[model samples]
Target: MKSFRLDELEAERAANDGAYLQFLRERNMSVGLYALDAGESDRQQPHGQDEVYFVVSGRASITVGTETTEVARGGVVYVPAGVPHKFHHISEDLRVLVVFSPPES
Candidate 1:
């Protein structure tokens, strides 16, 4: 079993590129913490693996392909493999938990 405290992870901001912090790695999945400050943009492209995003805090509009929606804390979003996605119009400092299935190479 593995455990992590969000506060501790947030405190490690210096080690991160203000984008993501990969916290766990397993045989078939990987978990990462992603954060974007207010007004910052998510410049990620399509992924090779399916992914799930759990919003930890803040608000933003996420675009997946041609669909876009606003998400806040406690909200969840899913993106299938090979789909284009990104977050924008961040109204607050956003913190999210990202999970990738089948592990990412």
Candidate 2:
């Protein structure tokens, strides 16, 4: 089994919007830690991954489907496969844990 401490992960900042640390991956799935600061986000298109996001710190407004939800720390959001979504925030930085599923499943 592989083990990773939080301090062992390399932190990478996006320079303009969100920062991410790619943590783990197995045969069919991967995980990451992402952070988005306020007013950041160029409204990019979704990259076609069925994503499960768990808020780890701060707050964010996530656009999904026809409605947007304000997600705070300890909240979870499910984004459907291939759907277009974006993250936005005003005051607090958005920190989250993300999981990506297997492609052929």
Candidate 3:
């Protein structure tokens, strides 16, 4: 069996310059930590794989397709494959736990 700690993953991500840090990957799914600074922009495009985001901390607004909603700690959002989505209007540093099905290319 394998295990991980969120604090450790977050620390690793903080040491990197990229906004996204992947911690685990398998044949069926992948997990990572995604962070966005306050007032920062999310320059991500639509993915080929379905994705899930669990807000670990902070607050922001996410636009998925034509809809936009506020997201904060303990919030969960899902985006289907090929759907346009991004985070904006960040009022605080946003940290999210990201999961992708069938891995991410």
Candidate 4:
């Protein structure tokens, strides 16, 4: 069994100066923390695997396919494989827990 602490992961990510820090990876899925500061842009492109995003904290708007909506703490979102998605208009620092099925090839 394995456990993780969000604060620890966040600190690691910040120390690495990276926007995302992958914490767990297995045969079925992968988990990571994604951070975006206010006025920053999410430059991610479409992925080959489905994904789920849990907003750990902050406020922003995400666009999946042609749909767009606001998200904040406790907000959850799902994106299907091959769909274009990105977060924008961040009003606060965004910390999102990202889950990708099939290990995010």
| lDDT, candidate 1, 1-105, per-residue tens | 799999998888546656888888899999988999999978888999999999999999999999999999999999999999999999999999999997776
Tens digit per residue, CA lDDT, model 3, 1-105 = 889888888788888878999988999999899999999999999999999999999999999999999999999999999999999999999999999997986
lDDT (tens digit, per residue) of candidate 4 on 1-105: 999999999999999999999999999999999999999989999999999999999999999999999999999999999999999999999999999998887
Predicted structure 4, TM vs. truth: 0.98
**Candidate 4 residue runs with Cα over 4 Å from true position:** none
Winning model by TM-score? 4
Pairwise TM-score winner, candidates 2 and 3: 3
- How many residue pairs of model 3 clash at the backbone? 0
Better of 1 and 4 by TM-score: 4
**What's the TM for model 1?**
0.94
Clashes of each: 0, 0, 0, 0
lDDT of 1 at 3: 96
Candidate models: Cα lDDT each: 0.91, 0.72, 0.94, 0.97
What residue pairs clash in candidate 1, if any at all?
Answer: none
Which has the higher TM-score value, candidate number 2 or candidate number 4?
Answer: 4
CA error at residue 104 for candidate 1, angstroms:
2.2
Give the least accurate 10-residue stretch of model 1, judged by summed lDDT. Answer: 10-19
